[model samples]
Target: MNNLEKWFHSNLGVLRRISQIGALVLVVLIPILNKNEIYILLGNFYSLSIGNLEIADPAIVAQTILLTKKVFLPLLLAGLIPIVITLFLGKVFCSWACPYFLISEMGAKLRSIFKTPQPSLKNPKPQYYWFIFAGVMLFAIISGVPIITYFSFPGLISSNIANLVLCGIVGVELFFIFVILLSEMVFDSRFWCKYFCPVGAVLSLFLSKNTLKIKLNSVACGNCEKLSESPCINACVLNLNPKKENLYPYCNHCFACVDSCQNYGNALTITFQNKEK
Candidate 1:
C-alpha cells in the first residue's frame, strides 16, 4: 500500500466510529420527535415503519397479502423490489438504507470499546432458525392474531412513545426506552440486530446472490505484510478480512473498506459481475 492509502485506512476507524454514534442518536431521537410524521415519511418513500400497525409494513409479507387492497403500492414495492434486488445486488438495503444497520454498526463500535476482538469472517453456518420463526409469525398472522406487530421493537418503541405522550403515560414507556438505551452502553448494541431482528433475517435470505459485494484482490493485497497490514480488514465494522474473504453473507457493504483502501491501487470496487455496461 502506498503512503496515501495507508493514511486513509488509518483514519477510517475514526469515521466509522463517528457515523455509528450519529446513527444511534438518530434512531432513538427521531421516534420521539414525531412518530406519525416519521412513519408517513418512511411509508411515502416505500420504507415501512413497523410502528404503523394500522397500515401494512413490509416486515410481514403475509399481513401485506391479507391487507393487499389497503396498502397496495407500498406492499407491492416492499414485497417485490427487495427480492429482485437480492437476486443480483445482494442485501444492499441492509448495508446502505436499513435503520437497523445503523444500530448494528453502532453496536460493532461499542464492542470495540469493550475490547471485543473483531468477529471472524469465517463462513457463518446457515441456521434456518429465522425461517422457522418467520413461519410461526406467518401462521399467527393468518390466524388473525397480528401478534408480531405488537411485539416489534422498532414499531413498538415509536408507537408506544407517541401513545404514551398523548395519553400522558410517557413515564413508563420512556423508562423502558431509557433502560434499553442504557443496555446498549454496557453490552453490544448490535445485539438486537444480530439475533432478534426478523427484518434483517428476511433480507439475508435474498442477499446470497450476484449483488454488489465486497471484493478482495489477493494479488494486490500482498498478504498485508508487504502492504500496511491489510487496512481494509482493520477498517471493516463487520470484522471481515476482505483480503481473505469477500463473500461472507453477513457483509453489509458499508464501503468503509473501499474508502479505507487508499493504498494497494484501490483493490476493492463495487460492480456487477458478468455484465457489460
Candidate 2:
C-alpha cells in the first residue's frame, strides 16, 4: 500500500538531464581530442567510433543500403547497436542523450518561465514531415552521401560545436537551429519532437512490448481535474497527458510526471512490471 511518494521520491529526471548535458559537452571534445592526438572518445553524429570500436546511426545504415546496395561491416555494426538499443529502450535517445532535445527543452522551459501564451494548443505530429524525411533519404541515395547529418539539428549542432571549438568555421546549420528554437519559442514548442523528427520516429518504431512505462494507480487516486494547469499535464515535456491512454511511443520516458505526481498528487507511478493486473 506504499504510495509513489514513499516508494520513489528521488529526482531521476535531474540526473537524466545532467547526463544528457554532459554527453553534449563531450561531443565538442571528440573532434578536438582526435586532432590533438590526446584521446578519441567518439566520432560525430552518425559515425561514433569509440577507440577501436565503431557505431553509427541506423539511418546511416539505411542510406548505405540505398546507395551501395552492400553492407559495410564497420558501419553495419555501428548502426546495428543503436537499432538494437532502440528495440529494448524505445525512443530513450531523444530524451536521454540527444543534445538537440536539451536545447529544445531549455527553450520550452524558458517559454514556460516567461509565462508566454502559447500561440496555439494544436499539437504537431512529426509524422507530418514523413514525406520530407523520405525525400531527404532519397537525396542521400541519389547523391551517394548521407545528407541527414547535415540537416539533423543534433548532428548539425554537434558538428558545428566540434568545429567551432577546434577552429572557427561556424556552421550555417547554427542559423537553422536558431530558426527551429525561435519557432518553438513562438509557436508549437514540442511540435518538432512530436511530429517532425524522423530520428525519434525511427527509434519509436523499434520499441519492444515490454519497454519500461509509467503506471498510474487508479485505486489510490482519483480522476484528474479538468484544468488547463494540471500538474501532470504541465510537467510533461511533450505536453502529453498521463491520464490519457496509450501514451507510449511518445512518452520519452522522462519520469517528470512521477516527480510531479509525488509533489502534487500521489496517483502516478513508473514501473517495469505491467500495471494491468
- List all candidate RMSDs to the true structure: 6.6, 3.4
Put down candidate 1 lDDT per residue, 1-277, tens digits, no spaces: 5676556555654654565555444445544555545443233112334454223334566455553426566565657655676667765555554544555566556657777555444523445436555675666666777555543445455445445544546435445535554565566444454445555555666665366666655556555564334667676665555655333455665677777765656677555564433
RMSD to the native, candidate 2? 3.4
Deviation (Å) of 63 in candidate 2 = 2.8
Clash number by candidate, in order: 6, 6
What's the TM for model 2? Answer: 0.83
Task: After superposing candidate 1 on the true structure, give the runs of residues whose Cα lies further than 4 Å from its correct spot.
Answer: 1-57, 63-74, 81-89, 128-191, 226-229, 243-248, 274-277
On lDDT, the leading prediction is 2
lDDT, candidates in the order shown? 0.54, 0.71
Give the Å error, residue 177, model 1: 7.6
Ten residues in a row with the worst lDDT in model 1?
A: 39-48
- CA displacement after TM-score superposition, residue 252 of candidate 2 (Å): 1.9
